[model samples]
Target: MLGAGLLPLGVLLFGALTDRLDANPIEHITHSTGKWAIRLLLLSLAVRPAQRWLGWSWALPLRRTLGLLAFTYACLHFLTWLVLDQFFDWEAILEDVAERRYITMGFAAFLCLVPLAITSTRSWIRRLGRRWISLHRLVYAAAVFAVIHYLWQVKADWLPPAIHAAILAALLAARFRFRTRPVSVAQSPGGS
Candidate 1:
């Protein structure tokens, strides 16, 4: 699972080294990282539903790893925007965060992942106890914000973002449709 998680990062790094990215390399990197972040996040969210609907028990254990990888990619996406796109221009960064709707949504999604990544460790899991599950539910909102961010960023081509949004809606709907607790022991907040 770790190898699977790192494959996207590896491909990104290889593209950077080989000059295989698009003419606008910064945009390419940002899009790739952001896309992967959203993909992994959705995959993490699907784990429980997959276990419930598809009866794939193996899917449950990969949730945390997938979520962590999604967070890592989100961080990289933000850094690419900050360092490569804006060249560390704090003013521009702030302006984008404050004024640009897509940027604001993406930044909000990234902020939602920050605490989840920080508390992903076993020790932090034990420390946070039941509060952890409530906090991690933020992923649902983050995923929504991320899809909105993608939808807002596109100019003419809206198909990909729309598909992602549809998938996310289906996944969230499945959660409510199936009243069973999530398969992850760490995330079973209200289960008796």
Candidate 2:
């Protein structure tokens, strides 16, 4: 609800703040939306590790919401680039997607996220059961592609994307470690 409300608010705020938005308002909107998408994706990935390491189980409930928010922002990012930046020129956009390596990577990432978002509902979760988890693991791949997309687009500065990549790596690593760790005795009832 908050994210849905904030989308338009963000667009309005950006429009109000700058007349031209640094000479390329469309590009600025595209980049900003893409950056926020990556940030939300990273935040979604961090929830599990945070819950496990910090014992903040409440974070679990927000994971799906955050993932959906990431997808929302990703859709906004793609639409901004497609409609606003390319002016709905399908031919040109197709050419760019085919020719631009970064765009292809970002497109692939966006594609991966679609299924995950679709399956995020309780109905899909119940229907898929264990397979749901394996399917949603696509998030890891999506995060990698998103980071690569950011890295490829930014010519001079790599620090921000690199930081997001690092966080993703750490979160994935934590999941692997958590899975393999022996169950702690303290987790058992009546055990100290």
Mind giving the per-residue lDDT tens digits that candidate 1 earns over 1-192? Answer: 889888988998999999998999999999999999999999999999889778999889899999999999999999999999999999999999999999999999999999999999999989999999898899999999999999999999899999999999999899777755446665578655
Per-residue lDDT, model 2, residue 34, is 88
Query: Which lDDT value does model 1 have at 84?
Result: 93
lDDT of 2 by residue, 81-113 (tens): 888889999999999999999999899999999
RMSD of each: 4.2, 2.8
Task: Give me candidate 2's TM-score against the actual structure.
Answer: 0.87
- Which regions in candidate 1 have their CA more than 4 angstroms from the true location? 179-192
Best by lDDT: 1
Ten-residue stretch with the least lDDT total in model 2: 1-10
Model 2 pairs in collision: none
